[model samples]
Target: MKNHSGHDMAGHNGHGGARPGGLSVSENGYTLEFDSTIFSAGAQTVTFRVTGPDGRPVTEYTPEHEKELHLIAVRRDTAGFQHVHPVMDEKGTWSTVVTLEPGDWRFFADIHPAGHDGTMTLGIDASVAGPYDPRPIPEATGIARIGEYTVALGGELLPGEASELTLTVSRNGRPVTDLQPYLGAYGHLVALRVGDLGYLHVHPEGAPGDGSTEPGPEVTFMAAAPSGGTYRFYLDFQHNDVVRTAEFTVRTTAVPRPDTAPGTAPGHTNHHHAHH
Candidate 1:
């Protein structure tokens, strides 16, 4: 069940047979229920809950990544991405304050019910009422800068195969060596496909205190694109006791077809179209 307001959006997560998470509002008898689908344009508190198959609010969950639930909010145009944890009340209601601009937004709840086999990602859309001017999706780039910090992305995203991607962090042209641990890892990555906002939450290659993982300079992860398309990546890393996010726009290399001629594989292309 899709849970957006009357305003219709584009894209339906067209890709390979395997469907990515966050495109549906309910899965496996669990549903994400929002109190309202409209809010004021600014910092506002939103309340929601998760209902089980019995139609009762779920109060128990298995903590993953050091949090009972992870809340991800992003505009439809792939802007204003935020990863936060909300406070759940005793009655199973969760509330969190999110800064919203005048545009359409998608909110995802990543949780593992007490008896579920694995984690499930449920998504819903809401609108911030006002005059909206959506921003175009940023071009494909490997480097992202935020507040004197530079993050360089290495490796490519291969369709239907695991590709190793490395991110090196530096500040003021110097390598950051004393990175602190956040959410039981040195970094947390969230990749969202440009069109449908298909979500992939990935962790680094190694954890802290594992004896082989260092605290600085480079963090690695293996990511696989569901299909050949453009994707937006958000990396949340901690250094100097502050958590900051670095964003990157990447396009995956298309897979070759057996019947196609040699050297006729789809090449790397940059998309400059405005997202609706």
Candidate 2:
């Protein structure tokens, strides 16, 4: 894959970081400035802008995933996930309509600013004022059902390690092999750590026209977690000329302790613990 730096990036995106992005409103001198953090309940347009290091709205941007900027918003409980592309005005202000409930919401802007060598994700918190009732994070599960479609996620997410995840799309108990291309790929995956909403946007391993990649039955992605914890994942794909998202709750696999091995020295175990 090619990174935002215009160089070959191994294992997917070249933006260098073991930890996920979108944990803050500013990074690498770029800030996501919101026009307003408070909104009324229901559907409304939210406006924002990406200010560069020069403290001016960034006008030029390198497109990623076929868009100049990708906007993601979700409630604090990982509910009401939305992946949208906002229209940017000449002044660089972006606006998109979002249906929000009475709760705290997070907005993530994933972009590559002009003159920057890597992509960055900036995040900010917003609130919809009303009577709020928070929902609990969904339980970890591999099978997710949406209407008549069933998407079964295979593979575990190992913390801080590149792990392969395969999602098989099936409808009405039949495998879907004619998946249409969306955003230049068979599927787009976004994973957010449960509590902090650390963001990771990942694409499938192969492109739509790549001879080796089939359209459906399975779409594969390589993803890494910042740490051992539960995460909420949203998979977007196109089928029957319509776009759909599948949601999943996944927990990272625990790193095994070496000291538990037979014949291991007790002194070595204590030192390892201290180092960890």
Candidate 3:
């Protein structure tokens, strides 16, 4: 087993902490390691191993979310999305074989602790060692309907920076607010970078002041892309026992200079871009 230094784990600016809420990445800053040099023409098998926070082995850990671990792998550009369950071997190693195309990618291990409601996000980056033209970002398509509660998405992203996104939702041409709460939060937003589908879980900032409730015909969120690329977004909202999803396309601009506003166009406040 390879050992990783403490500083290596601290270097990730993607998430606020390497180990938030007792969840830590493996020594190499990734929960899993893969042999990227090999690939098969059609259906190929790629093997990977999972490591624990102790930098040793992760054997017999507790299960959460109805599974020991929920693993999601996606190409950085949203080309592929896979939800997989890895087999935990007795030696504290979790292994899985996935057939992948030649491209750069990322993997996320969503681990839930036993008897705890919290889930840890552990991840790593890897690629199929070969050369292939990446697929272009698919056109932004999908309609946000009242009952569906989910949207189709498209966009681009930049790493280490925050981007502001505004989503407007209406039913039959009328603004829809009074959205009820779902999953203990006002809304659930999921973002995936287009090529690798690097996942960004986002939450909306609630209304200011205590015990105040506000629904929306418009919802705004701040999201930081994990890397620079095209991305797809899915926003899920609920009302009257019905869920609705709104999808949008976004392309993250390159990081600006320190003097420039992060999410603004040259000399313009991003607030002007509001969707309401």
TM-scores, each model vs. reference: 0.87, 0.87, 0.50
Ranking by lDDT: 2, 1, 3
Candidate 3 regions with alpha-carbon error over 4 angstroms? 1-107, 111-119, 123-136, 140-159, 207-213, 255-258, 261-276
Q: Would you give me the overall lDDT of model 2?
A: 0.81
Model 1 residue runs over 4 Å out of place are: 1-17, 257-276
lDDT of 2 by residue, 93-173 (tens): 999999999999999998999789778889999999999999888888799998999999999786544557899999999
Give candidate 2's TM-score: 0.87
User: Residue 231's C-alpha lDDT in candidate 3?
Assistant: 58
Model 1's TM-score against the true structure: 0.87
Q: Is candidate 1 or candidate 2 better by TM-score?
A: 2
Candidate 3 per-residue lDDT over residues 1-276, each given as its tens digit: 000111111113323112221123452333655545345434555555555455554555566423676566656665555556778767756666666777876677766433333445666776676676777666655444445333322222334434455565666566667776654455666666554344565555454223654576656555555444565766767777866555555665445535556554321234322311
Q: Give all candidates' CA lDDT scores.
A: 0.80, 0.81, 0.51
* Residue 62 in model 3: lDDT: 60
lDDT of candidate 1 over 59-107, digit per residue (tens):
9999988898999999999999989899999999999999999899999
Q: Which ten residues in a row have the lowest lDDT in candidate 2?
A: 267-276
